[model samples]
Target: MLRTLTRQSPLFTSSVRGFKTSAAAFVKAGDSVPSLTLHENSPGNTVDLAEETKTGKYVIIGVPGAYSPACSASHVPGYISRGGELAAKGVDGVFVVAVNDSFVTKAWGAELTQGKDSKVPVRFIADHAGDFATKWDVLFDASKFFGNKRSKRYAAVVENGKVQNAWIEPDSTGLDVSTAEKVVGQL
Candidate 1:
């Protein structure tokens, strides 16, 4: 009787079993960056990534979160220190994206550009709802560590609204594949 009931249950139906769906494919070379508005300080002050990259060569660096050890120490600093060199290589902008609120993102940017007298060109923007990363298929299930969805570590070089190149880390949390140095080298 138990076996029969289990088989008859709606939850155990074949339709339910076959309901699994694959995630969207990650962004690739030649794909246009999604038109998503990310926040710089608050929702009022927004940065439209697709619009920003429409006419320029830009690098988008995605991180799990702001103030995280890997991000604060090595990941972001790598780009921060090499901003000039990257610009010299013809990269017009370098954007750092995180799945945090705008306030945290702004504060973090302030900390990174403390003594530069506003010369640092890196724009640290907030993907408040993790929407931008999700659209690019770079959102990772970071519930265990971040308590919510977070972006995978990756970088994409975009030119005139399309991706020129993409470097995504094998492991979402790993630091090797998508570091600024490596991406810049590839550029």
Candidate 2:
């Protein structure tokens, strides 16, 4: 007879099952994106993914935090600093996404683009409670971050509503795998 497993072991079977369930909805390369409308911070105008990706190359960048050390110093700034170069290579639009509110996203976008004079302006978009993150499979339980959730550091290059490339960090939070330089290189 097979012995029934209990929660006595160091590892919980339920935890493993939950992990598998959570990992199943992730978006991957060659997968078409779902239709969603995201707004630009200032204008508050809804941008439809179906429409945006139909005409040009758009890059969706996900950040764990807006002003964190790695993100502020390198991840976002790296893209803002080199927006032109990326644009020149046929990138039509660049968007930064986070699990913050619309207001915070607006402020961060303005701050990031200040004094850059970049032709390819980066739009900081609020995922608003990780709805977008959940859809993209990038949401993390970052209670330490802000007593709530946050997005993973990853980048997806979309063309015509289809993912041309997806660079996701294995560790959930880090600058090692995902960066503008690396993502742009894929384009």
Candidate 3:
């Protein structure tokens, strides 16, 4: 029974079967962000990226998963700590996106925002189905560790729905290029 259920799971099925695409198709500077609805705490409470970025500058941080070591310890913290600095640079909001369920993402947000009076307005977004990551062409097979597809670590500065700058980590899981300090400096 367990074997049957495991085989039927989407992650198992997709990873086992496989999909292919051109690596050159990833989002880049000058490209308009794809329209998608990401969930914050629940699917009912959705954030529409197209509408959100229609007016001001937004920094989108894409991570492989929520609560991962690098993501929890450094990536998200850097952005949270530098939220004021980023805001001063004309950023309207910093969105941390991860390929996890809304519940997990929300819990992670709470963990990061704990004890903060006026918490850094960073939004934690859940790309549960990987639709947003797929559209951005940042979705990569992470089945070995995560059992499903995950986003390549990256950061993008969007102005009025179009990308003004993009920094994708050379090694999808590295913390070099997509760090908050590096991305904010590019902004």
Candidate 4:
């Protein structure tokens, strides 16, 4: 049989799949945050992020877990320390959501913000069974590490119930694009 292609054949193309440095994330600007019943401080206190942000601007930061290493040491603290700066950027409030129970979230929030300048009043919330993350399509199977599903680290600027901007860590657990400094600087 005769081979149709040669080294200089125009029909020949690389076999490697196409790769893009910046892939389109599941969350994007203009996406509406789901109106789910999330717990705040306790199960009795229910909050709907969509409803809360429907009439104002807010920053929603989703972490993999409430007391995880990155979340406790750097991620949450960064936002707490720079709360004033975030407020100056027109962000009405900043909420940290984790796929943990309200009790854990409440304690973690208090510990993280104990002596910090809470200019923007970062509200730590319990995503409560990863409902928010699943609805928003930011849930990932972290079973190997977390032993359960978890939310991807993301920072979104919501205005009038719509996402004005978002930065989701492509790897789901990294502390890069979703870092407080980067998100705040852009805003």
Candidate 5:
């Protein structure tokens, strides 16, 4: 069969016209962390990740939700349990960030830290509006599993407000990469 020319043909496409389509760049090594105001414990308490990372080495962990199964079971707990080792390796703090409200984050943080002898400070921060996740390029649509947008599971090693290294979950919310053991050992 012979094909006829059509307006929808690939040859008659925007790409062939040389129009460029661009997507926002994801946060990676050498990228400067943005200065987005976040909250810890309460709205009154503000956490500035950029400023916190400026003085020393820090790990910023992004999660999909505050009390989800994976996040509650292993992800955040790994970082909390290994906080001492992280501190010994010169890590100043571990910030657990989620796109939940301050109340949820505060309660989760307290529960996770209860009776744990973590040496480094592990602070659970609320990215209530997902602005931080968007800036980091890790925000995703999780309306199917979650109610709204959620952050991809990720870990970024920041030094002096610049990313030294980073790991983003290939599946958006997978458990393979960005584990505390994997990231901390490298640091």
Candidate 6:
């Protein structure tokens, strides 16, 4: 009888696994942000994410790496190309966040924006030490990926510091749910 009950309880068995094995990612709509104090690439300014989102609406776009194919070719460009439209649609701030250091983010920004003064008008920031990624629970082991930890592809739209929408990828590096088009639709 005891063995049958134990085998029957899938929910109970899963509850014990906790954060490590769960495919279901955390951040959900209406959840308050965890922290601020992130590093931006340009001029090396340290930004407080919470403070920046206070204006109106903010979009946090996370990618596996700064210069990865999907990220550079599509993920970022999708946002960069539409930055004006998004802003015109009434978004206050749009940020691209990656797990790499600030320098890489800056360079990636330049490349994506075509070396203009500010091609996208979006801030390209780095989450050094994986602080932001960890807080958001989107950080993943990427030892084989460019020799470092990396952020899983995801996007969040925040309003007044609360998440209005969260689209986390099922596969750590997949871009299905977190694409710019999806985020824009949410906005």
* Per-residue lDDT over 93-155 for candidate 5, one digit per residue giving the tens place of the 0 to 100 score: 899999999999999999988999889989899999999999988999999999999999999
Better of 2 and 6 by TM-score: 2
Residue ranges of candidate 3 with Cα displaced over 4 Å: 1-23, 117-120
How accurate locally, in lDDT, is each candidate? Answer: 0.88, 0.77, 0.87, 0.87, 0.90, 0.80
Runs in model 2 deviating more than 4 A are 1-25, 42-44
Cα deviation at 23, candidate 3, in Å, is 4.3
Which ranges of candidate 1 are over 4 A from the true structure?
1-24, 117-120
Best by TM-score: 1
lDDT of 6 by residue, 26-91 (tens): 678987776667888743688878777766778888888988999988887888777776776677
When superposed on Cα atoms, how far off is each prediction in RMSD? 3.1, 5.1, 9.4, 6.7, 4.3, 6.3
Q: Write down the TM-score for model 2.
A: 0.82
In order of TM-score, best first, we have: 1, 5, 3, 4, 2, 6
Positional deviation of residue 109's Cα in model 3 after best superposition, in angstroms? 0.6
lDDT of 3 by residue, 82-182 (tens): 88888788888888899999999999999987875323378899999999999988999999979999999999999999998888887788999999989
How good is model 4 by TM-score? 0.85
Q: Each model's TM-score, in the order given? A: 0.88, 0.82, 0.85, 0.85, 0.87, 0.80
Pick the lDDT winner. 5
Which parts of model 4 are misplaced by more than 4 Å?
A: 1-25
Cα deviation in Å at residue 150, candidate 1?
0.3
**lDDT tens readout by residue for model 4, 1-187:** 1255555575665676686686445778989989999999999999999888898788899999988999888887888888788888887888899998999999999888887776887898898789999877899998898889999999999989999898888899999998889988898
| N/CA/C clash count, model 3 | 0
What would the TM-score be for candidate 5 when compared with the true structure? Answer: 0.87
Clashing pairs in 1: none
- Clashing residue pairs for model 5: none
